[model samples]
Target: MSNELYTVIPDGSVTTPRGFRAGGLHCGLKKTGRNDLGAVVSDVPAAAAGVYTTNVFQAAPLHVTRESIGKEGKLQVMIVNSGNANACTGEQGMEDARSMRDAAARAFGVAPHLVGVTSTGVIGELLPMDKVLSGIERLPAAVSGTREGSEEFCQAILTTDLVKKEACVSLTVDGIEVHIAGAAKGSGMIHPNMATMLGFITTDAAIDAEALQSLLREATEVSFNMITVDGDTSTNDMVVAMANGLAGNEPLHPGHADWPRFAQAFVYICRELAKSIARDGEGATKLIEVQVEGAVSDEAARVIAKTVIGSSLVKSAAFGADANWGRIIAAIGRAGQPVNPDTVDIRIGEIVTLQQSRPVPFDEEQATEYLKGDTVEIHIHLHQGDGRATAWGCDLTYEYVRINAAYRT
Candidate 1:
């Protein structure tokens, strides 16, 4: 949690890490001329770890990625396409996903088992393989080990997102400078069980595949898994991480001396990316953060925090700049977490609207003004234990409705 161990790289991206190159291109996946296909290629086989959506109708690309990474716990190239979610297309979809993987392998000169693939956009439709394969053929030429390449790749993964989400940091591990960077995109259908949307993390640290997998899973629990937008988990949500071990440091694990610093930086990057996704929620005007403390356990606190932040009533209230403590309390109650009603406290910014579950008359105008800001913070104290957690969301607004009403068109 301390900033002393790492430095934030200004305008950093996936290519910021050593031995990584990224790029994106337009392949006619979308009606507009925006880049719809992208790739992040590691110079060598990199230890890989991934977490995918829990939605039953998982995308075909997710299965392909899992097979590639599960074989040897490493990946050399990761291909992604936007504007087509490659889900629910039956056996043809499976074949298409493998075809994409094969194309990426051939283009990048890597084994098919060393390449992973992902897709996002419209669901339940077959991908236009003609265009997708053409994009894959030209993909290698588009890639470069530069910031511009990373930027382009980020842009290509976006669907309804208004802005790209990325985070990068450098920390010293075993006296070697290690860099870690991530890029993500998600504006809607973002309630995550493991992870939301398409996220990619690249690091140059020397970490074992098992250790990296464990660390990434832990980070997702408190970061991506804690945020919600519309409470609809997509069919093609996943976060994939590759560690190229180009830092030339000692192998990292739980017992490594600098593991704490590395883990801290990793979790920080994920949380920042997740918060960006929440802030950029489809047509959202304001970012709302809910902090729940003193629950029976950390899991309980997480559930309560997510419940409060995900509630439509709470989001609507935030959009209207209303000090609606009742909605917050109602959410907390339904969270199914143990809460001593009489000892619960609630606050919107510094305005205390509820104290020990008793109404505290506060200046409604001040509360409204605070909620009207670009960011809102809600604090709930249960006085039950030491467990605490935080969740992020965005206010419900008319623009959100208008954007989703005709999203497919």
Candidate 2:
């Protein structure tokens, strides 16, 4: 929502003095000496809402934060670490995650429950607590409402990400200005039942817990839930939204007249952040948009869209810049949704690649050129009803395979 155009960078900063101070440090969790720990502390207790991976094998931080969110949609600080997922380490893993939250709460002088914790990296490994605690002790000094701090925070969130992801927008609602800024990190282990996504969104809007939760869920449904890179979800997937109420606007409620505008802003922020994740997907060279139209229902369309986007065959074709419509049709047939194959239509960009279960007469050169772009669109029409859905994905590349194969080594 800010007036600035989107820019690509390996490391960058974003600063919004709306009420939050953030810092990131190198706690030695990562072997590269890059910043791998981040802390976000609000000037005041903020309304918070979160959504975690549906995978039963959720990480300890997710389980603890889920309970905290249920108790109250509020938090004062968040601590995040990268390079070790801390998943499947049993009870000690949970304790270490709790200790991270507890240390942050103590450092910020807030209730332990008001501190949320998250980690990402290799699974089945214990977190390096000594380094994490040392980083926690330095959080206060690192905290700054400045561009340097923001850049550090963004850098601290990386794993296999080739570039840091950030989005921010400022909009005037009800005669008051509000700012929404967010940062996310994810490169591999991506799939829709939440993906490996880790997002932290900060807003200056005044909104209640219930409303914030509702908005975040709806926003994520259209954003994070509709993306896939590797079709593998992570145990540490989590997205959190925090509203510090720095904007003087009246508190937003579901029935309030300004609620729709506020919700739209939230959706925009989430969409931008989600798109950044896809663009920065592990070794991704292109961003793919899968658009499904005219399904039996919207839900069915979503299922089909995700299926097409997640198909390895389809993704591999995209990577090769091959305009293979058969893969798309094959994905649709096996999407587990009711579909009339005879009525399906598929297109790459504006070229109709398939029509009614057969290849349409179109120039392969044009389709290939479109596919070669940084952004690709795959459109499908079921011609059964007036329901539509769109999802985002990235092409599978050899670099992606290389990054993961050598990740643990």
> Could you give candidate 1's per-residue lDDT for residues 254-296 as a string of tens digits?
9999999999999999999999999999889999999999999
Off by over 4 Å in 2: 1-17
What lDDT tens digits, residue by residue, belong to model 2 across residues 95-172?
998899888888889998888988988899898899899989888888788878888888887898888778776666
Query: How does residue 23 of candidate 2 score in lDDT?
Result: 86
lDDT of 1 at 223: 94
**Clash totals for all candidate models:** 0, 2
